[model samples]
Target: MLFQVGGQGTRPTFFEMSAAQQLPSSVRAALTYSLGVFALRRPFIHKILDYEDEFFALLMLVLETHSLRTTDASFSESLYGLRRRGAKIKLKKSNLLTNSADEVRHTGLRKRQKVLSVVFLVVLPYLKSKLQSTYNREREANLQASLWGDSDERFDGDFVTGDNNSFGSRDVSNIEASARDRCIKRVRKIVGACYPWLHAGNEGLSFAYQLLYLLDATGFYSLGLHALGIHVCRATGQELMDTSSRISKIRSRERERLRGSPWLKALQGGLLSCAYAVLDYAQTGLIAAVFFFKMMEWWYQSAEERMSAPTVYPPPPPPPPPKVAKEGIPLPPDRTLCPLCLQKRANPSVMAVSGFVFCYTCVFKYTNQYKRCPVTLMPASVDQIRRLFHDV
Candidate 1:
């Protein structure tokens, strides 16, 4: 049922079209995750990476808009030899002379449909991601406030602490305070009541749509497309032209159109045409390259299936340096005594910075006060005190 013949065309398999549709998004996510990993150590780079979703959304908007405008297909759809068409239901007026049947016609999407689809595809995802992030932040804040009872303390402070009579009118102050308290309570109540339902609804809808998509229902590949009555179909033979052939045709048309112009003018137009062709090829090459690299990455990361697959053994560690003989023997430090307390070690702890042993209380107090190792005087903090299981 994925394909039906009104006019003969090579219908793309559901999986092929779906894969092509998801390819760009997959590429975007992979790139974002990779960049985040690489930039983890750089605070500035991490800050820039935070807006990666927005940046990709903008890029998709431009690419999809351009592809849709010129080719009647989004970028992925064009790459996959598919185009978006509006499915219009036409009713034939009952006529006595000849009988006409109601039929569905498919044509390029109108301007309004194109705009709406682009907004859904680009804006909706951006807003959804932002809303999810906001929800997480609010949830974490509320959890912390609940655990520490900070929210209650703040509310009490706001309610009980009124402005001085000398600073403001008593009636005005009470009114302002009451309004603020009510607003805060209302906001908290609304967020608590609605967020759970919103989250559950989003998850349930996504799961249902995915299940439908898996069943290969027509016009259900994308929610936006289904909602807007836009259908993706294979480009027929006459509609699908090779890129090179199209470029040649364009060049011929330009040449004929510019025939009466001066040689210089004609030359300029020719250069521009050549540039456009090159740019188109470059885009195609880039898409192919991305797919190639992604495939290679997947192949390498996947576990070997056959026993004959090559196994790479790491180089063995270098042999330790030969022990050197010394002229004088040095006495080792007393193991039973704490360095700082100078007594039998009790509840011993070690300074992580200096790796020196001391009584836990002694080390904790010293680091808390001096912020340094007692023996080595190296900069440290109370957090560096690590308790040792073994008695010194």
Candidate 2:
């Protein structure tokens, strides 16, 4: 009975609802929640974050009530392209007295429906979130108590605490309290067993409603609207944005003409100008904020990927193409002979800058003095005369 189909006019499609309603709501919540998380380390900020839902509810209630009163739509609905109207009630006539047909009324949201819708929009979500949070905490505590054999402490409030003195009084009290204890224990057990099922059932119902809404079988996108006898229809150029703009322009012209204390007028003008500017550019600013957050998210993800990726090193410089004696330098026919020393290499060392080998002492002395390979006459250094051990 709470959820009815078919409105007087065409209902907004699911995509329109998602874009105009769902996306903006999600972005707004995420933006505030992100700010809270960023400043969560500060005690005052953390306390504000703890009551985030309540704060959000109060803020949204004010905004929504204003919007509804003025434009028959919420801020997001007006900003994008949707408006809420009261669902039409159909009256069917019975033919026993006289053959009368059906009638449909075109009345917009009544005062009661408007109030109910606003409460459902702003208050219900906050209450639901609180209930879910409390349930989760209680469930976790119950689980801990069960695991650690601390059930007595957890259930202390569920039972009566009696006096230790007076044995006869205690006996009478025990007899009277036994039934109450059993009833309370049984109820607690039943509730404990039913909580999971209740949660699942709520989720299932929400999903079903969402599916129905998506399929256009429901006149409202959310249960709140449906329960309050409200319908969302595609907004057709009746938004208050244009009216607000015109009013702003008229106020600006009037303010410019009005006479006042020069300094006070200047201050008022500055503040009003800033407020008007914010109103005009709020949508663009929200878009820019979303873009900036997305860019930051991408940057962080890329940085993380770079950190997680494996590093690579260039393959060790290909063993400097097997060192060869210079064409002009005369050398022994045996390639194993050091080109500089002209003897079988001993403590052989190579000049890195040029492809030639010699005894470490010979290369060190020559390069230290001339700073070049003796065989190739190319610039080198004593540091480049790396000594090699005889493998043989």
Candidate 3:
């Protein structure tokens, strides 16, 4: 009797395994296959379907308050179990098999599954991509605005009270500004949908983004000004006042456009001006400090050399040679020519240490680069050269 009971249990287990094998695969697999087929036919569909699993998983988590695996198991198993259960009901009602009730129930369940498959595989991805594109536009607009500043240009003439030329220009400016503002507003609205803090009229966030941009602009301007100053000090003798005035004008214009009350505007302007002044002063002071240090170093070196030199007394000179003047003989080659170029010295100058004559520009350039005399190879400097005036 125990052997017979075990045999019966084994028969049911075999039947169940057969039934499970006949059941459909998971809903996620079905959806993925459908999306893959669609993407193959329409290449652009791939963009939305690339993250199909993630999107469906997130949707399931939000709606059912469970993970994708749990939800998928429940969906696929329940649908297959329902069909099997309905078949068992039909078997019990075999006497009334001619009644069509089982067929109607099975048909309804199939229709419901079809609708669900369509929604998950098609509708959800389309909506998500649309929403994503809208938000993307807004983010792009915000980035462009921050980097390039506002695109709007102010019109100097009034539309209604101006002459034909002025009216035309004003109209054109207004049209351009309106188009640009419209685009910006559309993008901003989309961004605000995702991040409400970035919505229009959110003064705090807007001001913060603008302040960061201002700081970046100020830093770049300061660097450029510093470079210009160095160029002026080395190559040209121009004053910094002109550059300062131009920068002030630009700052004033920017401040005028900034959103603020008169007092606030004035305060910000003052702060920026102060910052610019500090930068200018720092650059100028650094240049002056370098020059002062160089002068002190030279003084110290000269003092040391003077103290290190030997003090020797020379013997008296012999009788002077007789003076002879003969114009017929060819004179020896002029030794005053520049050794570097072997040419008559133009703009003649003397190196203080070597007491040698050379072209002022040639020797000055050489010393400035190498810090030594061209002929004697002794240490020299451009500053120690004295311009020589010859009586022609």
Candidate 4:
């Protein structure tokens, strides 16, 4: 028999054997296999799988709710444990799938779940802010290093201050004073340069500059909204009055001058009568281009004739009236459930002037790309449209 002993110093007690010390190869091999199975069943290994299954199930629920479909085997492989750099991925692909019956119950597991939920809900928001700050710090450091050579102690890398003072201003007050004087000179020169377009009421050029300033303020993606905004902006009553007054004065002066130079007027009339040549120099914006064409066409015409022309001003253009199902028409609404989504009930709002009725939502969803009305080749509104169908 071997004696087990304990030591107070650095050495650990080892099992002491008799003369027949070494175990046989078969016994050692069996012991190694047992140790491998025991190691594989460690608590932490199970814990990851448990969390992953729950996490993946939640994700699948999310994707399914958003109309995505998937299979189980693919999801299983995703959840299988794969060690990455220290931090673990919270969810595995296999973890993304599980049925209600697969759920396990344990009081401690529930408490741990609550703890996880609290961490995600409470700490995750601030985690992003912390990450943002870290990114900004790293970005600023990169900018500093790029601008100036790294210091001996990382002279080229990120630094609070640099060796070069070339970009620095003399002082705030001196800079401001000099800036003020320069601004005054710049303002004067800009006024001189813009005098022609300004007095000429070049609305198109002015709108371009306004749009560019807005792009600089916000960003590129917002250009569409801002571009559309320009129409509403200068359409104000005050702006309209100013433009009208300028155009009226210009036209009146031209009419008076033309009375004395009929020969010159005739000469200009011949050259400018070519509509395409006149429109070649037309300005930006659809409305502006139309206005320019009208101006050029009516420029040499009599002012009396211009004033006498029936004007389409102020009142907005009216939209076409809804189709009145042509007196004796029958609306053939196919009452059927949607096979894809299994939604029951046909939508009457999307009655194809030809009589086929579909769910307004489905009709529009399909029609958007197809550009054909589900029932007929009739047009449809792209806006989040509400349908109003009156019974014929």
Per-residue lDDT of candidate 3, residues 144-228 (tens digit): 7798765553333543664567666577788999899889787668555755443334446435534543453221111221222
- Arrange candidates, best lDDT first: 1, 2, 3, 4
Q: Name the better of 1 and 3 by TM-score.
A: 1
Query: Candidate 1's error at 210, in angstroms?
Result: 5.4
Q: How much lDDT does each candidate structure score?
A: 0.69, 0.66, 0.48, 0.38
Question: Which of the two candidates, 1 or 2, achieves a greater lDDT against the reference?
Answer: 1
Candidate 4 residue-wise lDDT, 1-392, digit = tens: 11123333211112211101122122223333333345586745555443433443443333222211111101111112100011111344465666322222111113333333234323542443344444555556557768874444453465436654644555677689879967855654455455445435544644554455444332111222233221111022443355447545754565555533778887755554453233322212222433444464466466768788997779888766445333322224434643223455345344444344455677667567656444445655445334645422
Q: On a 0 to 1 TM-score scale, where does candidate 2 land against the true structure?
A: 0.53
Across residues 1-392, which tens digit of lDDT does each residue of candidate 2 receive? 01122234456656656665564455565566466657856657776676777767776776677666655776567665566778676656465357444343434667887788687777766766766666666678678877886766656773445755645667778787988977866765666566678779867876777789978565557767767767776555444465466566776686888568999889888887776566546546555655666677788899999999988978886665544346535666887887667888888876777756677877787788887777767777787766666522
TM-score preference between candidates 2 and 4, better one: 2
Q: Taking the candidates one at a time, how many backbone clashes does each contain?
A: 0, 0, 0, 13
Off by over 4 Å in 2: 1-10, 36-44, 91-106, 151-199, 238-291, 310-392
Worst 10 residues of 2 by lDDT: 1-10
RMSD of each: 13.8, 17.2, 37.1, 44.7
lDDT (Cα) of model 2: 0.66
Task: Give the top-scoring candidate (lDDT).
Answer: 1
